[model samples]
Target: MRHTWRWFGPVDKVSVREAAQAGAQGIVSSLHHVPTGTAWTTEEVEKRQQEVRAGGLEWELVESIPVSESIKTMSGDWKAHIAAWQQSLRVLAKAGISTVCYNFMPVLDWTRTDLRWETPIGARAMRFDLIDFVAFDLHMLQRPNARAEFSAAVIEQADARFRAMSDEKKAALSRNIGAGLPGSSDGYSIGELTEALGRYAAIDAGRLRKNLIHFLSEVVPVAEELGMRLCAHGDDPPWPLLGLPRILSTEADYLEVLRGVDSMANGVTFCTGSLGVRPDNDLPAMLRRLAPKIHFFHLRNVRREEERMPCSFFEAEHLEGNTDMVAVIAAIVAEEKRRKAEGRSDHQIFMRPDHGQEILEDITRGAQPGYPAIGRLKGLAELRGIERTLSHASYGLA
Candidate 1:
């Protein structure tokens, strides 16, 4: 696997040179300044490429070209947005970039209730506390039918939790959940969130799935023609949130997507942390089954607080969470061998240390949440060690 690091363009606190210094061979980036629904110009693509090249690293993949809300909902100006997306892909291919990753989660991107939950070792990691989320949903956002979504026991717990919070904590919780992540297109105020939720009133899981298929059916051919791979990222929590449908959460969901598109150009971005949040997902088995269609990997892990649905989880160390990191890497190594034996061109996959805790100098640096420098470097070193050991011992690869 090619080691890559995600870098937000010029504005990011973590520079491209820093990513290179941390041992990343490539940079995963996007034209974040380009607004959603706008076609990317060749100049912009080349400019970002130049920035990455200046750091002595290549821009390997586009972390995302934000899928516009119109395209996801198939609402106002949806066709135009699709055209722009295709245009962006063409521009990227013209610039010598082949792999792209995007997601279809409604309203928000990857979210967490706490951005700096201090671990026992004094490192700060992101966390998603179920009780806190429920409290926000019921008392803060006050979405209709929100109470019905939770069990009576959970509702009681949420009420108590909400009551115990001071006004400052309440505001912080709302900001953490409603405000979008680093590269997300836009964040929502409370009223804006409610309005966005209303747009999806008629769209359920089935309808959303169809919309995604329609998108792939339209865009996958363009990608195929250009010999580019378009990988859909899995939902962050791997479950529905704010009553929105989460279609790309499980193995069955991915199978349905692959079947729906039925093209190598349409693929999956295998993210261990996201999918591993669900206990039933057998990571190694799923990797083996979907190896042929997986074009990108986010190798991270999370520790689940409970065994039940809607349970809370915190980002754990790469090898310390519920996921069997050794087994997962072994499966990947085996898949690479199979692809090589088959004489396939895309034999080596692109992977990154998805997220890391804030440790050491990371605490004072104020790097993007879950994207600290030393933290990710530590993760990359650990992952590289595992991959090398597995390749030499089991797969017999140099």
Candidate 2:
């Protein structure tokens, strides 16, 4: 497996050189300056790709060409936006930057209710508490159907938290949820966020998933023709987005989308941490089955709520999560072996430590989605150890 680092364009605090030194062979990034609904020109992609080559690393993937909200909800002029996306794909193909990772999570790319929740180690990590989410949805946004979405037990817990909270604390909670957290398109206020959520309210999981398939059907071939892969990462918890259907939460979703598009380009960034959060998920079995379409891999661990109320989340060590890391790595090793036996050069999967917890000296600062130095460094080290240890076991020849 070839590891890549997600760099946030030129302004990223972490340099491409740093990424190279960290042992990443490829850079997973995007044209952050390019707005949604606009085509990313080949000139821009080549310019960024050049930077990677000069840094002694390859530019293998564009982590995203952020799909517009217009395209997601089919609001207005979506065809124009989709056409632009297609054209951009063609442009990227011409430039030879093929592998791309994108998400379909509406409004927020990913949500965390608290960015500064104190960890037991006295470090700050992003926390997604159920009560905090309810506090934002019911008390702050005051949606008409908010109460219906919560259970009696959840309502009781949320009510107690809401009552105990000062106005400033409540407002902060609302801002945390309403503001769309970080790594999303942009910050959203209460009104803006509620309206955004409302746009997807009419869309159920089936329709949303259908839309996602529709998108892949259009763009996947262009990628495949150019020998590129489009990897879709599953949005975490509650499965699908609040408004849109989540087709990718289950193995069937992956199969359906792959069949819908019928292109080699259509694949998945199998994220163990996100998929592992669900108890029913069997990562190794899924990997073995979907190995051909597994374009990218995300390795991380989550500590599930042991006995907590409402939402008891777990943030475990990279090797210490609910999902068996050793087994997952073994499956990956098996995939590599199978692909090699089949004479496929595209078997080198990309892996990254998805989201790690904040720890050590990073306690004082804000890091994007657990991208702190200590956390990621620790994760990379741990994952490297696992990969090396398992490298020998899975492929006996190694």
Candidate 3:
């Protein structure tokens, strides 16, 4: 696997130089300033490339070219957005970037209730507390029919949780849940969220899946012609949220999309942290089965707070979470060997330490939540160590 780091460009708290120092051989980034539905110009693409090159690293993949809400719903300007997306791909391919990662989750990119949940070891990690999320949806955003979505027990728990919070806490919780992640264009105010949710009133999982397939049908061919890989990231938390359908949450969902498009360019970005949120998504087994279509890896772990669906979870230490990191890494190494024996040029997958706990000087730096420099460095070191051990000739695992 090629080690890569996600950089949010020039304004990011962590610099590209720091990424290089953290031992990243390449970068996974996007032109975030380019608004959704707009085509990226070659000048903008080359500007970022020059920045990454100056740091002595290559821009290996685009973390995303944001899929606009218009395209997702097939609504106003949807066709135009598709054309713009195709244009962006042409520009990227011209600039020599071959892999692009994107997600189709509507309304929000990735939702989290707490950006600084304290861990037992005195580090800060991101968390998704189901009760807190329910409370926000019920009392804060007040989405219609939200009560029907939760079980009676969960509703009761959420009611109590909501009542116990002070006004400041309530506001913070709202901001954390509604505001989007660091490089995402989908952040929303409560009013904005309500309006967005209304647009999806008629679209369920099946329709959303069809929309995704339609999207792939339009864009995947361009990617294939460009010798580029378009990998769809699994839905974060791997479930529905805010009354919106999540079409890419399970193995079945991935199979549907892959089979729907039926091309090597139409692939999945095997994100263990997102898919692992569900108890049934056997990471190693899934990796082996989807080896051919898996194009990128986000190797982070989560410790589920409960066994039930819609359960709470926190980002745990890389090797300390519920995931069997060793088994997953071994599978990755084995797949690389198989690809080598097959003489495939796109054999080595690009991976990054997804979200790391905030620790050490990271506590004071106020780095992007879940993207603390030292914490990710710690994760990359551990992951690299495991890959080396598995690939060692004595182990015969590679």
Local error of candidate 3 at residue 247 (angstroms): 1.1
Clash count, candidate 1: 0
Give the per-residue lDDT digits (tens) of candidate 1, residues 147-185: 889999999999999999999999889888987756654
**Per-residue CA lDDT of candidate 3, range 318-367, in tens?**
99998999999999999999998999898899999999999999998988
Query: Which candidate gets the maximum lDDT versus the true structure?
Result: 3
For model 3, what is the C-alpha lDDT against the true structure? 0.92
Candidate 3 regions with alpha-carbon error over 4 angstroms: none
- What's the distance in Å from true for residue 137, model 2? 1.0
Whole-model lDDT per candidate: 0.91, 0.75, 0.92
Q: Where does candidate 3 clash, by residue pair?
A: none
Per-candidate clash tally: 0, 5, 0
**Per-residue lDDT of 126 in model 2:** 64
Q: Please state the error at residue 378 of candidate 1 in Å.
A: 0.6
Can you tell me which runs of candidate 1 are displaced by over 4 Å? 393-398
